[model samples]
Target: MKKALILSTLALLISGQVAAKTWVLTDTESNTEQGNWHISSHQLNIKSSPFSIEQTVLHGGKQEGSKLLVIKSQNGLTITLIPTRGMDILRVEGFGVRMGWDSPVKEVVNPAYMNLESRNGLGWLEGFNEMMVRCGYEWTGHPGMADGQLYTLHGKAGNTPASKVEVSVSDSAPYTITVRGLLKESTFKKADLQTQTELQYVPGSSQFSIHDVLTNKGDYDHDYQIIYHSNFGQPILEEGAQFLAPIAQISPFNDYAKKGLSTWQTYAGPTKGFDEMVFNIAPLSGANHQTLAAVVNKAGNKGAAIHFNTTQLPVLTLWKNTDTLKQGYVTGIEPGTSYAYPVSIEREQKRVKQLAPGQSAHFDLTYQLLHSASDVNQIKQDIATIQGDKKVEEISTPMAKE
Candidate 1:
């Protein structure tokens, strides 16, 4: 029995459960671990079978209304957000990028439709509002996908320079992403994958970390925005899913297609049968920052709160979309620095934030799951607690970038 116990302990150590391990997968291909599912760094090519988390959104942006992540534990507990035929395929397309219900679903403009882009991946990476080539910025898709495609720091790099792989892990288990070679339009020699941006994760939850790693290797200052866009499926939202946000008005894009709902109005209480909603907030100032969240539902209310420090990012945008056309099923809770409208409009409106060269900025946000609540009071209370004493930040720019 002692020998068996020793062997079991050794096995656990080899399997790497003493602490969580962050593996840096590559952007070009999918990585699979035998029995486990296949995953790319971008998280675009999720496995399809064994009832695991399959990619629900398609490359064409066809599946819009439902959640797409499937999570299966080694213990045989199967939980999915909203898995239907509509939610079966992974969408190479993006939310507001192209062919969005807003106006036209232009494939060329769709970064997912493109085989290559600047950044292509998952978990809340922001895309610039505009496409500027001279700025060394080429539209790849969203920063998540665009960055995933153009650059990747995969594999492990030991301390030895000769043995160092493109990717490396310090004594700390954080997976580090490194970029080598000339960046699109900047000039810098070195950059580190910085996930300084963080969100709170449940202690024992299967999904633990939502992180971001940014680096500037350019000569000129990089003025960009990065956001978090989370796609949720069923299992997480049953018949009575609800959402909440501390916003004054919900407005349609001044540029995109007109209003499906309305441009600017009071926050709708509990939107049951709606497609999506968008809100606006200013840059971060004080230590206590403002945020928005999804409230209650039959399954469970899961959402995140966003906080941005101006030195790194200057704006915050809340994007909520449901596939009313699909089956009234899933919703995407995306908190970004910029809106879906054109960057030209944002700069025209003077809403864009600029990041300087070699300078770094940081922020902290939290994503928590909640059960059914009595009313929107819980949300209001949480917001009040988070933003206590700090003044509510508002949009002061309506001027475009020149």
Candidate 2:
């Protein structure tokens, strides 16, 4: 009986030690654990999942009074969005690498402080730095009067807050977290527009998807335009970084872009007094109407790529500004339904899309961070294949009437 009792005690002690051991799966490719771990125990068992979504409010500074949703995946991707800022995605991080530019304004400022004055008013540009700053439903450009009505810079979409914000997580394999926000832009007896925006992230992947639906809820036909002004900054947009796209044609929007046309694909270190340049590009499309563009850092072996539907968003704008290194140094890769020019110009060109009452349009875009050198190289090769045997055509900018 004594020997049997001692054997039972020994078995219990052995099991406890075995359960206390931690087991982790190391990623051979990256030589890291990548957060896949599990611990066994008698009292409880804990395991780490591939993805997580969290919501929190930012306090103090410019971010005061802002509710933010943070989505993280095991693949080292993290995205931050502000529901108060028209559900705009403010920041994207992957593997300790920031994929967006840092705005001068440290916090997300309240829209109450928006300055809409023409000559002196800055509108949303005052705090314009975001991973994705949505433009439109109305006008998006310099402040001007269209049809005797005043329009501010980039319109009011970014300033309009969202309602019915929801965050949902999937329980099945390949777990995904999705956040949805509904924004209404309207005025009594005037125009009414409802924009439904969603951000989705999947586990074990460095990509996030954005889906948006814009509807005209007014009685009269309404002009609608939108641009996803996605920006990339340092480390990704550094001295050795390059912009790669399957462009069929490139039109310079100003004399500055024309003068530097030879070096449009190359980037320069931030310089003082550098004028911002804009280019309108027609991207080569695939059979399914897919298009791709990327900004790659050769030195850092990192890159950021965008996959979008060219049928829905046919125009691509590249805005490069090194004007003020400390204050405003960024490269913007914008895909939109219309050019970033004034609404009047788009109207004259018959490019302004009118949404009939009760009609809606949908847009989809995906951003992927290339964490591995091989992944970056693969994208570069793809862009090369698309540009094969064809030279990039340079055309004059479409003139806007005075």
TM-score per candidate, in order? 0.46, 0.84
198-253 per-residue lDDT for model 1 (tens digits):
22122122122223334444455555544444444333433354444444333333
Name the TM-score of candidate 1.
0.46
- Residue 228 in model 2: lDDT: 88
Model 2 residue 191 CA deviation in Å? 1.2
Candidate 1, which segments miss by more than 4 Å at Cα?
Answer: 1-203, 233-241, 248-250, 255-277, 281-287, 290-292, 298-330, 361-364, 372-380, 386-402
Write model 2 residue lDDT over 80-137, tens digit each, in one string.
Answer: 8877788888888987577788678777876666665635435567768788888886
CA lDDT scores, all candidates in order:
0.31, 0.71
In angstroms, the error of model 2 at 157 is 1.3
Q: Give the TM-score of candidate 2.
A: 0.84
Candidate 1's clash total is 52
